[model samples]
Target chain A: MNLVLRAACVYMALLFVFRVAGKRSLVTVTTFDFLLLLIISECTQQALLGQDYSVTGAIILVGTLVSLELGLSWLKCRSTRFERWLDGTPLVIIEDGRILRERLAWLSVDEEDILEAAHVQHGLLRLDQIRYAIVERNGAIAIIPWREGG
Target chain B: MVEIKRAGDLETSEDLAFERTSRRVRRVARSLLYVFVLLAALGLFGDGPLSHARAGHESGFFVRYERFARVDGTTRFQIHPHPGSSAAPRRLFVSTSLFERGHVEQFVPEPASVEIAADRSIITFPRVESGGFVVLVMRPLRPGALRFSLGEEGGPTLDLALFVYP
Candidate 1:
């Protein structure tokens, strides 16, 4: 029961923080980000497990975490709004070679970032070469190149 | 970027979209595994929060300590004896490389005298009543493995090892 409570709290806390931190934080990974992640996990483990290091305690913690995740996934699949809230709806940042500066600013994305993704993802060489640019749920910028004939 | 005019349908590509999300999840899982490996290597799961080893005598009077600790932090060391009044307080010499002897603090019940020395601290328990135990609170002076024993080095039954983090 304690394990379940701890897991639930940690899950909600992480969800809230990631949502508040926005998608860009998770999408962009630096060397320091990896180290920060490890530190956070270490602290979380201490809070979750307390001083109980038995095999049973370990099983309980794992069980609680997996169960909570499965429940959230089930909820997400059933409710579109819940899914949107859990994973923000993707935003279309560019359309027909026109940059949506407002939406791009909202996500703190830049023209350079978009161009970089465009070239790497779809061989788009310039802003005018892109037909559509969307910010995907996972935080990566997606580019749709202009049709050759169109 | 390769595209067709949304054709009046602006919905994202279902297949590629799903792949992107799954790839992200896979990356996250990999990162979690990496951290887990690090924690396991540090023996944190065994000695830190998940430690289930209680303070009890298996062969001789022993102490189970955190093999790893942080400098300037405190850890509890519990002691359980052989259910009787040992009139003579046990004279134990503590030798540690990881902890500063002057900075080491102790908290125990009555009838225990701790003598701080240059290389060791003598912890003597004077006829502790039944059900009474000794609890020592020690602070690390440096970051390394602090080794000590209740008696002579290598021959002491109550030997302990603590690693301090800087």
Candidate 2:
């Protein structure tokens, strides 16, 4: 009982914290972000296990966390409102070579980030060469280049 | 309402209203987080100014303990026994509930002997003068309200309560 409750609480807390942190923070992982992830998992491990060192305790914790994740996913699939709230809808930040400065500021994204994604994904050099740039729900930028005929 | 239109021949779906509302909600959430951190720092969570507490009586019996403690986190409980005019060793009676719920890690000025009774544990201390104290380093095993009592045998008993956080 304690094991399941601990796992559930930890899962809910992590979900709220990461949601508040915004998706862009995790989109690009820096060296410090990787270290931070390691530290968080270390702290979570102690809380989940408490003093129970037996293999059964570890198995129970793992099962509890996995079950919680499956339940949340199922709930998300059933309700579009929940899916939208849990995973934010994609926003178009750039259209027809014009940038939406306000949306970029709100998302903590900049022109350089869009251009970098463009460069890596499409090898495009200038903003004029792109028709649209969208910030996807997973925080990755999707770029559409102008038609060759145009 | 959402608007679906073509951007350079590729269809796009955008909900400007939802985006605006979500941005506002995130702003509020960040502001609340700052307040939460401030409260935790003020000892509302534990181990801060509000957590330190003391209880005792005028009979020279006193105890220092934490009003709020964390499960599995070590905390100190100091007991001061009144050294009367007579120079005889003192015996302390502690409720068994304390031992049952708290794991004693160490004891200062170790008791000469511990005799367990049905409801309480009697700890005998060596003869001492005034200003002598016994310290119990304990880690609470469970979370929630922990109630216990301690005092010298045939003397005043001080009841202590601690709220343990998980």
Candidate 3:
């Protein structure tokens, strides 16, 4: 197989995958999303550069994977219940300067990570200064400072 | 004092209008003056030949070849690499006597090495790699206005000459 033709096929496959993966995949890199990214790159490499690779075989496999992703994204976008099932909602890990240990454990986030993110993003150095903290859907920590007036 | 407390006259609407217009004109004049100063500075010091030379040097080496006036003697050529690019180490290749009309010559680097004399009168390069610019340095085997087609891959090519230096 010619190098240029193989390269073009791999490029098209990647484009199709990205389009089907939905906006959330780009916005956030969850553990699952990261795994998908690695797998996709590996698969494309096999198709483009590997000796035993067949362009038609690679295209078929990539097309099927993309179709599945598109179907899931469509379902998740249309139904709130389905979206919740596929993409879990954010959980509040802290409220009114009190840590919610249960929610933190559920999200697999440690207190140190939350504190560091808080200090970095909002300049909230002390735990007592944080009024609210939430683990956003993208796995990022958001911290709200306690109101001075309050 | 009561008799002296007379009425004070305020400026008319026309006067207020004139004052506003004068203020606007003054603002516009100031802005235009700033623009004129900027353009004058640019014209005096910006986009001149010196700046262009500096820019070309900063971007990459400049290579020029003059026509060969006399034949059968070695001519000196010098190439100074672009400012930040001197560290990469480059090569110079040459195919002489290529000006014979309708005669095509294939000259590949023998063993491919890149090292030139301190005076830059010699040409050499290392083993071929995937990328990098090649500067073709021609020393005519025989001189009498020789023209050669020369360029490196991914770089500009031109037909030029090296005249015999008196």
Error (Å) of candidate 3 at residue A67 is: 2.2
Off by over 4 Å in 3: A1-52, B1-166
Best prediction by DockQ: 2
Give lDDT tens digits, candidate 3, residues B1-166.
0011111221111122332343454456557666755854553222322222211232454443233322222232233333334444344433444534212222233424533333222244443343333333333334234454443333444444433421
Candidate 2, residue A18: Cα displacement in angstroms equals 0.6
- Expressed as tens digits, the lDDT of each residue in A33-99 for candidate 2 is 9999999999988888888889999899889889988998898888767776778878889887789
Question: Could you give the TM-score of chain B for each candidate, in order?
Answer: 0.57, 0.83, 0.32
- Model 2: docking quality category: acceptable
Give TM per candidate.
0.52, 0.90, 0.33
Report every candidate's CA lDDT.
0.66, 0.84, 0.48
For model 1, the stretches where C-alpha displacement exceeds 4 angstroms are B1-9, B12-166
Deviating ranges (above 4 Å) for candidate 2: B1-13, B57-59, B83-87, B127-129
Candidate 1 reaches a DockQ of 0.04
Residue B60's lDDT in candidate 3: 53
Chain B, candidate 2: TM?
0.83
lDDT of 1 by residue, A26-85 (tens): 676889999999999998888677657889998988998899899989998887656765
Fnat across every predicted model, in order: 0.00, 0.31, 0.00
Mind giving the per-residue lDDT tens digits that candidate 1 earns over B1-166?
1122242336663233533464466467657767776886666743445443343364445565666665555776666444454675655455644244325566565436767787666666666555555666676656566666544223344556665654
Question: How many clashes (backbone atoms < 3 Å, residues ≥3 apart in a chain or on different chains) does model 3 have?
Answer: 10
